[model samples]
Target chain A: MQAYANPTRFNALALTILPWCVGSTVLLFLVGLYYSLVVAPQDYQQGETVRIMFIHVPAAWMAMATYTVMALASAVAIIWRHPLADVAAKTAAPIGACFTFLALVTGSLWGKPMWGTWWVWDARLTSVFVLFLLYLGYIAIWQAIEEPAKAARLAAIVALVGFVNIPIIKYSVDWWNSLHQPASVFRMDGPAIHSSILIPLLIMALAYTMLFLTLHLIAMRTEIMRRRIHNMEQAEVQG
Target chain B: MSFTAPHIGFVLASYGLSALVLVGLTLAIVWQARSTMTRLKDLEGRAAKRRKPAKQVKPQ
Candidate 1:
């Protein structure tokens, strides 16, 4: 990890791995869409409406997963003072925010047909809303401050604090009486969803994950370039 | 697969929105990267010129 802390090594590795990541994302998305639209069995109750879950659920999963990644990266930046850790956390914010927004909008679109309402104050919905706000706030902190170091420190703290909501979002359906359904994929007894639906859902989730990786590497590389430009500017000013 | 379903509008909306957001983001990132790289290269070129011998400076 420390060896890759050097931006040159990180850039080389990211360049090498990014093609595979992008390729897998494209392949999975195509296959997943085919399965989702044509092959997966429609829900008995929800009928064709169940198809929204393919996009909605995966975006929600990525939303929460990206925040967890940001929080962990923030922790590394704080404790280990890893040089690139802050960069990882900072670059992840807009990407995570976009995913969170998609999850909310898509979920709302799914809800209108299923629950007879476009929005709700249920535990699951409310917690996810808070998670969205948290992403916005994190991004706001970065944009609001001119000093990058100060902004990074404050944003890391906000990320760590907001992480308390991640578990709540995951377990809201379980811990409270809510309109949202309980976990169907990751459970002690294994997936409750049928294999036909599960396959496409898993494929879509994999595609989302790959897309995140591909974007993250590009964002990180761009950030490194930005930092280099800043350094060069400072040197010119001094000289 | 058929758009003949009752709630097909919602499906179309969902896919359309996803494509729009993802494509917009990709374009924005690519634009930012290109612009910043150009700026950095221009700055480096200026700095290189400043370090060159005065006699070698091409009159502009």
Candidate 2:
């Protein structure tokens, strides 16, 4: 972690790992999709609607996972003043926001058939929605602040504070009588679903994680370049 | 999976919507990275040029 704190070394590492992430993401998605859509048997209860779980569950997981990454990076930025931490946090917001949006939309699609409603103001549903808004607010802070240092500090604080919502979203179903279903794959009982469905679910989740990593590397590289450009432009004006 | 099965529309909707959003997100990020890298290289080249003549002038 400290080693990659230097931007040059971080850039090089990101470049080296990015290609492998891309390749694995493609392969994993292909294999995961085949098993999820082609091989996995439909749920006896929900039947065809169960197919939505492959995409929805992964998106939901990534949504929370991305923010967790952002919060960790933000903490490093705040505490250790790691040069790349703010960059990582800023770059991740959009990707996380997109994942959150995907989760909500896909969840709704799943809920319509399973719950007989498109949406509800329940604990699980509302908390995930809050996560989406938090992403937006974090992104807006960066865009609105002209000073990079100040923006980074403010955004990092927001990210750290907003992380409280993650647990709320996760345990909302368990804590309340909600329209959303309880945790099936990641519970104390160790995945109540049979291995047939679990395998593809895990594969899709892995693929999503790889995809986020690949995208984060690219986004962070772009951010570093952007910062460099800003410095050069400032130098030119003063020169 | 059976396309003709009941509630298949919901299943298709979920997959289709997820696909569209993910693809769009990927494209947007890639485009921004490529364009930003290109601009950064251009600016760096300009900055190098700006420094080169100044060094020679200082010695003269």
Candidate 3:
């Protein structure tokens, strides 16, 4: 990790690994979609409506996972002053926000048929809403601050503070009377779901993860280039 | 998977929306990266040109 503290080396590594991420993401999505649409059985109660779960669950997971990545990067930026850490945190905001938006919309799509409502002010839904807001707020901070150094510090603090919401989002179903369903995949007693449904769901989740990774590397490289341009402009102005 | 299945519209809508959003986001990021890479290369080329020593003129 320390070896990647230099953006140039990090960029070289990202270039090498990016093609693999893109290929795997495409393959996973193809296989995952096939299983999700054709192989998985319809739910006993929800029937065809359960198909929404394939996309909704993975988007919801990635929403939280991306923020976790941002918060961890922010923490590293603060603790180790790792140069690329700030870039990682900054670039991840938009992607995480998109995931959060998908989660909310898809969750609503799932909720309508299952719960007979488009939305509810429940713990799980509300907490994830807060997360979406956090992403927007973090992005806004970077745009609003003219100084990169100051923005990095302020944004890092905000990310670290907002990370408290992740656990709340995860366990909200258990903590309150959420209209949302409780955990089926990750549990102390092992997964409650059968393999038929679980397998495709896992594949979709992996596909989403790979997609995030591929996008992140591209965003990070773009950011490094932008920073270099900024520094070069500053040098020209001073010299 | 059957189009005739009950509530298939909702399933289709969810998948459609997710695809639209994710693809749009991915495209936007990739586009930005391409433009930024072009700009960086341009700036680097200009900087290199500035660093090059001017050719010496022979006394005429």
Candidate 4:
């Protein structure tokens, strides 16, 4: 990990790994989609609406997972001043924001039929909403500041501070009465769901994880290139 | 998979929107990568050209 603190080494490593990530993402998505749409059985109670679970659950998971990645990267940036750490954190925000948005929208779509309403200000929903705002706020800090170092520092602080919400989002359903369902997949007793449903759900989750990885690497490479361009421009002006 | 099934719209809409958003995000990142790489290479080429010494003119 420390080896990648050098931007050049990180860029070379990212280039080497990118093709594999893209290939795995595509293969996983194909297999996961097959399992989700065709192989997975419908729920007896929710019927067709349960189909939404494949996308909704994975999106929610990625939303949290990406934010966690961002927070960790931010911590690395602050503690060690790892050069690529801020790049990782900064590149992750928009992707995380997109996942958060997808989760909310898909959850809303799932909710209307299941809960007989479009939305509820329930603990789970509200906490996730706050997370979406945190992503936006962190991204805003980066954009609002002109200096890269200043922006990175401020953004890292925001990410670390906002991370308090992650646990709240995870436990919201259990901590309070939520229209959202409680932990079924990531529980101590192991997934409460049957194999038929759980298999495809897990596959979809893997697919989403690979997708995040692929996107994150690509975004990080772009950021490194962008910074290089910035440095060259400054050099040109000085010279 | 049945179109006539109840609440099917909700399920289809969820998948449709998810596909749209995820694909859009992927495309945007890929496009940015391509553009940034191009710009960086262009700048590097320009810098290299600038650093090259001017050719000596032949004496009249």
| Candidate 4 Cα lDDT to native | 0.87
Score every model by TM-score.
0.89, 0.90, 0.91, 0.91
Top-down lDDT ranking: 3, 4, 2, 1
Q: Can you write out model 1's per-residue Cα lDDT over A17-111, one digit (the tens) per residue? A: 98898899899999998999899876777767788888888888898899999999999989998889999999888888888888889888787
Candidate 4 residue-wise lDDT at A90: 100
Better of 1 and 3 by DockQ: 3
The sequence of per-residue lDDT tens digits that candidate 3 reaches over residues A165-192 is 6676657654565355544322111236
Clashing pairs in 2: none
Q: Give the TM-score, chain B only, in order for the candidates.
A: 0.86, 0.82, 0.84, 0.83
Which one is best on DockQ? 2
Task: Compute the interface RMSD for candidate 4.
Answer: 0.7
Ranking by TM-score: 4, 3, 2, 1
Instruction: State each candidate's chain A TM-score.
Output: 0.90, 0.90, 0.90, 0.90
Determine the TM-score of chain B of model 4: 0.83
Check candidate 3 and list the clashing pairs. Answer: none
- Compared with the true structure, what per-residue lDDT tens digits does model 4 show for residues A133-209? 99999999998999999999999999998997667665765466545554332211123688888888899999999
Task: Give every collision pair in model 1.
Answer: none
What is the number of backbone collisions in each predicted candidate, taken in the order shown? 0, 0, 0, 0
**A1-239 per-residue lDDT for model 2 (tens digits):** 78887888989998889889999999999999999899999788788777788888899889988999999999999999999999999999999999999988988888777767788765666778999999999999999999999999999999998997667665765466445554432211123678988899999999999999998899899999888889888888998
DockQ of 1: 0.53
Instruction: Judging by DockQ, tell me the better candidate of 1 and 4.
Output: 4
* Distance from true location, Cα of A226 in model 2, Å: 0.3
